[model samples]
Target chain A: MTVLINSETRVVVQGITGREGSFHTKTMLNYGTKIVAGVTPGKGGSIVEGVPVYDSVKEALRRHPEIDTSIVFVPARYASEAVYEAIEAGLNLVVIITEGIPVHESMKFTRYAKLNNTVIVGPNCPGVISPGESKVGIMPGQVFSKGRVGIVSRSGTLTYEIAYAMTKAGIGQSTSIGIGGDPVLGTTFIDALEMFREDDGTDAVVLIGEIGGDMEERAARYIIEERYEKPVVAYIAGRTAPPGKRMGHAGAIISMGVGDAASKIKMLREAGVDVAELPSQIPGLLKKVLKK
Target chain B: MKLYEYEARNLFREQGIPVPEFRVVSTAEEALKAAEEIGGRLVVKAQVLVAGRGKAGGVKLAENPEEAYRYAKQMLGSEIKGELVKKVLISKAVDIDRELYLSIIVDRSIGAPVILSSPEGGVDIEELARSKPEKILKIFVDPVVGIREYHAREAARFLDLDEQTLKKAQQIVIDLYKVFEKYSCELAEINPLALTPEGSLVAIDAKIILDDNALYKYPEFSGEYVRDLSYYEAEAKKMNFSYVELDGNIGILCNGAGLTMATMDSVYILGGKPANFLDIGGGARADLVERAVSLLLKHPRTEVLFINILGGITRCDEVARGIVEAIKKTGVAKKMVVRLKGTNEEEGRRILEENGIYVLEEMDEAARKAVQLGGAI
Candidate 1:
């Protein structure tokens, strides 16, 4: 079974009335996601694309109690409250796409979700899009097709580029999850890698990392410890990032001296994962790994 | 996102943590008044954003009001780093018997906040960690459980602190954890948690870097960590552009900091001088691109404008639109060369073509075009 998501997954949108939430809801709907209901406090009576918008997650659940998964699209300030509300409603698979949710808020929600036995995808991520299984959040649906390659990335836009590159090179994704670029994110590369390793449909994996943070090194050790049989391709961004500048994401700072791209690339290479220098070379590298 | 020493100390005071008595003064008259109010030899420290004030001759001991005024007069408006010192912190200098280093930072390795303590203090911890790592003791706190009493005790005992001093150090560490979590701080450090002659531990210096995303919740807590830029400057900063006003002859624009810096270096590297380093990150929208270009062209010395964006999130087509929009909006006649890449490459090329603009994809080609245009000017 694929990890975290499946065909039976029922997902609801938290900030379903906002511009980003509304636009991405339509996209996710087009990808055949089992989007059940929408949540917005003041815009409860209104409907988006015929989906009923409830005043709260509890109200949404009263009409559709079968809702088990949730996708948050609220603003950064209110993202924590939205996540807590969804978890309180007994939803399991939570995916938060809000970019700037505070780390403290995230810690609280992640702590609660962990206590309640719920799997939270992202507070800053681009959400998970499983080809032909289920789709959630804002990934381009047209670019992805059902296939064997699994992807886990720190950066959102970079994931799209790599997925596009892979598709153009005749490779498709089993599931692509953007684990977020924040320093204190819920899920790391290791969690996603373990999922991909256990996933029967996933034949290969592509891990996209960035400079700053030691998540890549931890994943490298996990691969070596578990001795994953499937071929893996890895690429870490920000090789040319100015030494001390905190690039886009809050977590991209090289504070601990462990998350540098060169060191990560070295560790990944040592763990038998083929590393790609350029995004364009991902497909060629994946093809070579698949031949093994 | 990091607060100066005075700002962090104020935050510590608010959180019920003991900090040295201090007052912020912007002028020498105010500094002298503050020193008189404190009624003792005050430490007049230049309040710049960067650290190492002690090493930079920014921190001075003043025995009287005149000395304090003199120190403040000399330090204020003087450049400590690249930043000009606009304010000074005057605090009652503590009689110190010994100094210790205590800092609480989010350790990503364990996915939890960790407390770092060193008995050998008053120096750079990074340098200490390099020279004598054994003196530094680390205590990790579980995110769920938080910093336990035992955790504090271990840090205290590991640092070889005295029983009474250990209790104060323990409470200080606990209070730091509270501040770290309560404010969503990425880092809260007391560089020299000084043990005064009175046998009390006082936070002589403090540094806090509140999580940027958490700034909304901590608005009331906002004091001086903010970079003190104007509204437009702050917006430009949020957009990830490196903007510096320079006295030059050509306006240079490029994407990627490394590329932008190298572009300026190339302009200098090739004997053709550049005006400024303008880096519009890889994700600039049309509005941002237009704004950036317009801002660069605002300089009187900007005779020629060069726009370079290696689009990944910021597509070439959008950059082209931005350039066209800027031309329509501000009518910048500084002869410009635009370099664009990534998705919609052809679209960007066609847009620039239709608008009668010179577009190039290579950095050298774009730089050469700018040089040729500047030479013509």
Candidate 2:
């Protein structure tokens, strides 16, 4: 009943021998994710942290037909090709944790994933997690609790902060996904919202958004048009963020009002979603919305 | 990274795209010499990254070499749109029969490289798109297939060019696409692809924004393709921390993009302004945290240092070690508000508390403390 990943999900690690790949592989393993195989392109016939490493995603898939999900920690330049390999190998979901990928490369793989109907979590984002079931990506597992809230965001550390706040407030989450902060992303807000809407276990949703891109605006409109009945609580990150300033690797060049947090908050408010003024206010807002 | 006009011109010339015969000069005397060597009425254009330089008097037409020198002197060491005109490009001013606009940039809406062309160019393209949408023709080129001949032909036809000019324009469009890809540019634009009275198409002005992500692969752009960084920015660069200066009193040190921005917003919402934004990117150990905290304290306006660390891959205990080390090294007796949660939270809080640093468990409480300590000005 959980979306994207669960205990039944078998996994493979692309770039599993890399510093980041090998590091998160052990983390995912400790989180109780079924790490069945690893893909390192040329480093086959090897193993990382007791998991078999194949030379290619195809070979790994052959050895473990049950592997349905993959975590990609490939270097930024080679990230797109790795995602394509995962998609071509027929992995149902590909979670990319690498940051600073060129927008062009991100577009190519995201489009490929789309045309093939394979779900992608992020190229510059933290991956998704279903607490108490299975964990993927790099969010600290201790901060997440199994419940009805479906959390999605465009940030990594930010996701951890909110997830921690929720956990501290005794709120449990069904699934929390970081869709990435890049202007061109694999999964959009509407896409994640739709997935949560269909998942029977997700009773409410917490959307953590930031300034930059029109994804949040579009998501708000979609909520109104679809009349999504879930008690969605939203928290936008960059109210004082200067426009077009490169905040970080995840910084956005907001050309106009289209990408501003103000417009997004307005749209979400008009859509009848409870928008929290601060990240710390999110838990209370969600409780208020759920109680109503 | 914005390429200067002179650099873009050089790139165009190297690509065999027709550009006006030009020479770059740093001084008025050199400008006069170059203008005299060209032996014609010249254009004196300031070599800077900012836009609206033309209207800002950074661009001028000189009837003679002496006039070119006068213009250069007026421009060099002068500020246009907040960018100093360090160099001037002097070129033989061509007689224009027409002007056209062409640009190729990655468009998010299309999810591919897009070609935007307009016959009535040399003006603000955004305004043009807003007012006369019909004047602009946008073509979304397939990323895999790239800029095919037919896509260029489609763009040329949209510009209403004659058969011969259409062919020439088409080739130029294709060449521009190559430049975009070769240099890893996010945007390559020809503001006025001027058609001269001699029936020759020339790129009089060019703009290229090299993709920032691609900078690692193209290290040459550090001095060539970009402007000089501010003092703090350059220092922060060496420290491996993402720091941007702002006009405020509270200095923010945090991990993760979302958390840092949330901290900034929290400060503003609580009636405090952040002096700078610093993200010791995920997995920052003690040294980085110490270095970052020291950097934040270096700013004169920074009165209250707010440390917000939410541990995911970034351990709170490591951040605390950095904070304690920074306090020791910098000997900063200023007020600091620390919010540490997630992994190793208890250890991190204890480390800060043992060092006489004030710590708050809640973000709201930490922000309130920061604002209260920061006070007015």
Candidate 3:
């Protein structure tokens, strides 16, 4: 079975009245995702891009009980509230596309969501996509296609860049998820790697990471400890990023000794995963692993 | 953001932790009056955020109000660790029986909050943790259960205080934990939880770094912008954009954070040094691009401007137009290297070319062009 979502997965859009919410709503629909309902605080009983809008997640769930996944497009302040509402409504997967969320707020909700057994893809991240079958995030649709490789990353644009490079090199993906680049996030590299390990559609893995966080190093330890035999290719950015300054993402900083790219690459290579020197070099490395 | 010592004292005072009588003053005359009001022996401290203020001659003890004024006059307008001293905190100096250390920090490794305490204090904890590991006590607090009285007792016990001192120290531990939790601080610490000669505890110096993300809920957080930022930094802050100035010649602008860093790496790899790291963020419009370009060109060291736009969600044409508009408005003839890819590349290239600005097809070539144009400027 495919991981996360398939073509039959019913979806709800939070903050559907907002510009990003409405735009991505159309983008997802165009990519053949099942858009069942929409939710905004005050804009109920209306339709957004031919999809019904409700005042709250509760109302949306009541109207459409088939809804299992929610894509959040709310702003930073109300993002946690939206996630809480979705968790309360019993949705299994919630993908947040909002940026600039506070670390404490993110920590509270991520901890809360984990306790409830709900899967959250991002708070300040691009959401997930299962190629050909279903698309649930705001990643450009033209760059992806249905295939056998499983992909996971902390970066958004670089995810698209590498995936495009892979597609150009005749490699395609089964699933690609952005776990967000925040300091504290709901999902980690290991979580996605574990999912890819179990999924029958995925034969190998490509982990895209950047400077910051011990998640990549921890994932390497998990790989070696579990002795998972699937081929994994990794690409980590920010090789020239300075120490102690945040480079865009809340989580992408080199502070207090961990999360540098050089150390991450060394660890990944030691774990038997092929680590690429550049984003453009990933596909060739992946091809070599697949041939072996 | 880190709170000044005097500001941190106020927070400690509110949490029921005892602080020595103090006044925060901006001028030398005000420092004299504050010294007089506090009476007794006075400690004149330069209120800069940097550490090792004592070694930097930022901290001093005064025998009289005139001496206090003299110290404040010398410290103010002086540079401490490259940051200007804007305010001084004058506190009644306490005669210490012993110096002890206590701190509650957000430990990312434990995935929860933790407290560190030591019988030996007034020294850097990092150095202590390195040189004398066993002297420090570490206790991790569970998030769901919250910090408990037992946790505080454990920390006090580890510090090896007597029964008489243990009860009061435990209360202070709990109070510190409360400040850490309530303020959404990454760290809440008192380096020297001074043991006064008269059988009382006082937080002589303290530091609290609030989580920037959680600052939204703390509406008063805006009033805490006390740091002296560089010219472009303040302008960028006012515009609600992320801009960092560096000592280099090539100015850069990119949409996403990862892409921006990658661009910088490319610049450095191709022998170009980026003057600043400017991220317009994802989905930026034409006007934002214009502002970003103008700001980059405004820097005196900038020899060439590099704009790398991978327009996935953001349209490429808008970026191209922003470059043209910015150059036309600012009239800054600094050389620019442009790379426009992803969505609508052809039309974006057309827009730039029509405006007499050339767009490169490859990021590598564009970076090379920028470096060659800069030529070690």
TM-score list, all predictions? 0.85, 0.95, 0.94
What tens digits encode model 1's per-residue C-alpha lDDT throughout B1-377? 77777878887999888877889999888988888888777888888766677889899988876788899999998998667999999998899888888888877655577899888778888889999999999987767678899988887676566788788888888888888988888888887878887788888888888887777676665443237553434656666675544445767676654345445544543445666556675557889888887776666677888776655445788888988888788866668877765557899999999999867865556767777777732
lDDT of 2 by residue, B227-293 (tens): 5566787788787677777899999988887888889989999899999988888888888888888
Native contacts present in candidate 2, fraction: 0.64
Pairwise DockQ winner, candidates 1 and 2? 2
lDDT comparing candidate 2 with the true structure: 0.85
Alpha-carbon interface RMSD of model 2?
1.7
lDDT of 3 by residue, A199-223 (tens): 9999899998889868888999999
DockQ of predicted candidate 2: 0.65
Higher-ranked by lDDT: 1 or 3: 3
Error of 2 at B76 (Å): 1.6
**Which ranges of candidate 2 are over 4 A from the true structure?**
A256-258, B222-228
DockQ of each: 0.21, 0.65, 0.54
**Model 1 regions lying over 4 Å from their true place:** A256-258, B36-41, B62-67, B144-148, B220-235, B238-289, B296-320, B333-350, B357-377
TM for candidate 1 is 0.85
> What DockQ does predicted model 3 obtain?
0.54
lDDT of 1 by residue, A68-146 (tens): 8889989887888888898888887789888777766676667778888878888777789888888886766666777
Give candidate 3 misplaced runs (Cα > 4 Å): B109-111, B132-137, B197-199, B224-228
Predicted structure with the largest DockQ when compared to the true one = 2
